[model samples]
Target chain A: MIRVVAGFFIVMVMISAATVYSLKETTQQLKAHKQQLSADILKDRAAIKVLRAEMAYLSQPARLEKLSRRFLALSPARADQMAKSVTSIAGRENFKQVAFPVDEFPLLLPQEKPVFRKKTVIRQPRVRKAGFYDRISLKLEKNE
Target chain B: MRSADLHIEGAKSGALEVARTRLIVPVSLFVFGFSLLLVRLVSIGLFEDISDRVTRRASAKTEIIRERVDILDRNGVVMATNLPAPSLAVRPSLITDPQEVADRIVRLLPDLNRTRVLNKLTSSRHFLYIKRNLTPTQVWKINALGYPGLVLEQAEKRVYPQGRLASHVLGYVDMDNKPQAGVEKFFDDHLSNPERSNDPLYLSIDVRLQYIMREELERAMDKFSARAAAGIIMNVNSGEILAMTSLPDFDGNGAIDPLAPEMKNRNILEPYEMGSGFKTFTVAMALDSGSVKLTDEFDATKPLKVGRRTIHDDHAKKRFLNVPEIYTFSSNIGASLVIRQVGIEVQKDYLERFGLFDKPVIELTGLSRPILPTHWGEIQSMTVSYGHGIAVTPLNMVTAIASVINGGRLIPATLIRKNKGENITSSNDYPQVISPATSRKMRQLMRLAVEKGTGSFARVEGYRVGGKTGTAEKVVNGVYDRTRKITSFVGAFPMDRPQYIVFALFDEPHGTADTFNMATGGWVAAPVVGQVIRRIGPLLGVKPVMDVKTEYQNLILAGNEKK
Candidate 1:
């Protein structure tokens, strides 16, 4: 009886010790994870700030205006450019009115139909006799 | 023999009692202690809740360390924000090799002075700063050097990505996180509060419109060779400043001298006599007081004399002119005559009602006070009527003009953007400065002026523009200098129902070849307003109706009624 009781008490103490040890280990892991997540959040926030500043800098009105003027044919929309209604625009002489189809999704029609042009073919150079270095250069050019 | 037998029996019983006592006490104590331990273990393992506590511990260190809030335009474009930066400092005493460290740092940051860095590194001082607000890559390179004396501290930098786009409006933040000027200085406490710093402040300014206004004003300034120029566009109904610009502006990110010419915000902080721009107020007050009708004729045939001061028209009609004709012609003599009928007391009351007697209230600091005459008499009244004796900022003029054209209710100008569904009219905050009928008539007078009078150059195609022109000889050395003049144009669009007010001013502009060597308001400033309206009208979503004559039929009909 004495041996049996002593064994039971020792088992209970070991079980409690194990529970405490596992809890402490888990708490430490969680704390480290929490720190890592915090560091990641800070990094992400800093990156976002940089991206926002870059976007604003790139989209500055003066810079955009200069770029648009240089590259694009588009300009600020004028008051007269806008139509009061679709019917008003359709009433124009150049406008081609098309009916909407019931069975398919709607598609916007371009004001003017796109024209198809024949593709031009390039003429090849005549082959000539080459030296050793010239042949190697030609091969290198072909690889590039 | 019986007594000895009793004593031996008693001794045996006592020994047995002692053994029983010892065994029972120890057994009970061990059993009680074991039961307590078991109960505690069960409670902890099965019943006690710790997930909430664990989560609290996990997230406690992740709380955001808030800095100053950002400033955004009406469209949620970030005008100003904070970026995390690394600052490099070194302990002079701990640096083992100052020469090597300085050389490495100079190579990392080319902008730093090598000699200065060496001096600081070799100094006897305990600590010294090498540089601040270093880029992450630079900080990394410096850290890789692994110098014991080099220390990196976390810091934040205020950045303005728009540069000089709205410099005067956004202002700039100092290195110490101090608010310096404009809205920054105005909303310091609110922006710095940690709890509210996450939320950005939205200003009423539209950066696109601001860019357009500044571009056109700068173009005009270049063309006319003006000393300075200022322009403002406001929602006439809500009194929100959509765009305001003052030329020779400094960049918000660069260091600025506080007293430099470029640092002056010409739109609000500088007061000008405003010349005939005040005539709009005169005519509005005249009609509102019922003392002078639109058809009432005033004699502009000759110069009028009041208190030894003669008032002459810059462009004399030399005939009896009605109120609308007088306004269209910008007749100073006629404006004085109209104000004469309205009386000085009534004029003063109207001026006070228009908020011209005080500095215009806005969400900005360093507002210029209106320069009023010390003595209020006949000459002061007449000169003030034609915008001479009294001086007010262009902001004040815009606000008062907005009230006159926007159905006569005086809505205070605000730089802070209003929230969606915010009821501006329900609060009864804006007081009626004039009758609605008078405001409509004033709108017509302005339209007629733009259509036929000195403001003809301000007319834009399809956008029915109405405005008045002012060309005032600037007061120099206590005398009116004819060589120097301040020309301005104040107008509103869509004459039938005006929605926006535009004001353009130029200081001492020299006449260009295109202007016929004339630097008057109609020749210089009016065209600037016209071009601005032409470009911004579409952006502002103001629809253009082709038939402008029909819209002005009411004005024509009203004029013919008394003719």
Candidate 2:
């Protein structure tokens, strides 16, 4: 009975020791991973800071103006480029159309006579039913 | 047979006792050892709190420490930030060959002196810094050299990526991590607070408008060959300074002498006799008092003598001018007469109410107080009417003029971004300077001035810009110097409902060929304000109201045109 009790105590201790050692190993690994993630976050933050500074330096108005002058055909917008409302712009466009009516263009000049030309019509090709041998011959010709 | 049985039983009992004693010894030892182990494990899991300690250490290692918070524009653009800069230091005792190491370092950094570096490396000191704030490439090269004695210390260095853009506003941080000037000096505590260092401080400045105003002012300065120039653009209703610039400004990232003349923020720090820009206030004062009407006439037929001084209009109409004509023609005699009618007490009260009596409230260092005359007498009031005797900073002038045009409310000027709920109508800090009706009339008169008078050069076709021109002889050694003049213009647009106020001043501007050798405010300063409005109007999203009938036009139609 003493031997049996001693054997049970040794088995229990071994199992608990194993569990504690494995738990300790996993905890250490997790701790190391957490540290690595934090370090990565810090590195990323610094990188983002550097990138922001670079972006601000690149997007300065004077530099942008110089770049635009060199490469773009755009100019500062003017008041005339903007309209109060869509209807107002549409009205302006309609007024521009009315300002130069197509019918009035000739009447305003009335100096040149109109030229006349004969009308030409386009012809459509006719379709015809084909035999199986004809279709086979056409396919053979396409293959060739 | 009974005797033999007793003897065997006794022997059996003795063996049993011996076996039991041996088992109890081993069993007690095992129980004591196992209980100790179990107690240790329980204590470690429950009482010791190992995980708590680990998490605390992890958090401490990851916490980022910053030297200072970033400064940003209203649009969230980084105006100033801190960048990681690795510094180089060395232990002299650990170095075997100082000359070779110094030579290699000098080769890597061309700007460093060879002899100085060698001396530092060979010095008796235990440790010394070779350089601070090394570039990334330099750090990489030093790391490649693999010197265990050479250590790279991690540090943060403040950098302004925008360079000279808004330099005066952002100020600079020194190597000692001290806030030197401008917004940096004003909010040093808040910026250095470790708890809030992660958040950035935002100003009311718009970089685009700031750039536009600075570019135009620099161009104007070069064109007119002025000694100095300053410009300001403020939101009229909220009193937010959108852009403020003083020319000959230094780069925020470069070395700066804080005592240099260019370091002065002329917009708020220097006071000048703002000439006829004050006439807007004079006219506003006259109309708001209910003592003088817009149609009331002031005699500008001749020079008016008050005590030993004689006041005359630069552009003399030589006639009895009405209030609109007085403002339109910019007649000094007419403005004096109007102020005289309003009396000195009323004038003083109105000027004080306009905040000209005190320094302007803004987030900047070294704001100047308006220079008032020692004695409040008739002659002083007469000269002050046309902005002669009293000297005020451009910031004060702009704020006061903003009040006049923004429907008679005196909103204090600010550089910080006011919250959405904070505005002129919602805030009780702003005082009513003039009646809304009088404010409207003043707007009409200003419109008339820009439309057909001295401020005609400031007129932008579709924007309806209205303003006043000021040309004052700068005082030299207690005497007015005719050759030295300060010309300025203060205006707002779209005069029907003014939103932004633009002010430009040129100190001692020489006459250009295009200006017909005329260095007056109308020639030099009005066009600057006009050009600024033409450029920044669209950027501010102010829609150009075309063909809108203004009060000035109606007055003109009624045959009440003053000019």
For residues A62-124, what per-residue lDDT tens digits would candidate 2 score against the true structure?
998999999999998777676654457654554423342121101121232333554767456
User: DockQ of candidates 1 onward, in order?
Assistant: 0.18, 0.17
Worst 10 residues of 2 chain B by lDDT: B554-563
Candidate 2 all-Cα RMSD? 17.4
Extract clashing residue pairs from model 2.
Answer: none
* lDDT digits (tens) for residues B154-208 of candidate 1: 7778888888888888777777778888989999888888788668898989888
Model 2 error, position B131 (Å): 2.5
Each candidate structure's TM-score, on Cα atoms with residue i matched to residue i, is 0.80, 0.82
User: What ranges in model 2 sit over 4 Å off?
Assistant: A1-21, A91-144, B1-64, B552-563
Q: In terms of TM-score, how similar is model 1 to the real structure?
A: 0.80
Show model 1 residue runs off by greater than 4 Å. Answer: A1-24, A85-144, B1-65, B103-115, B550-563
Give me the iRMSD of candidate 1, please.
Answer: 8.6
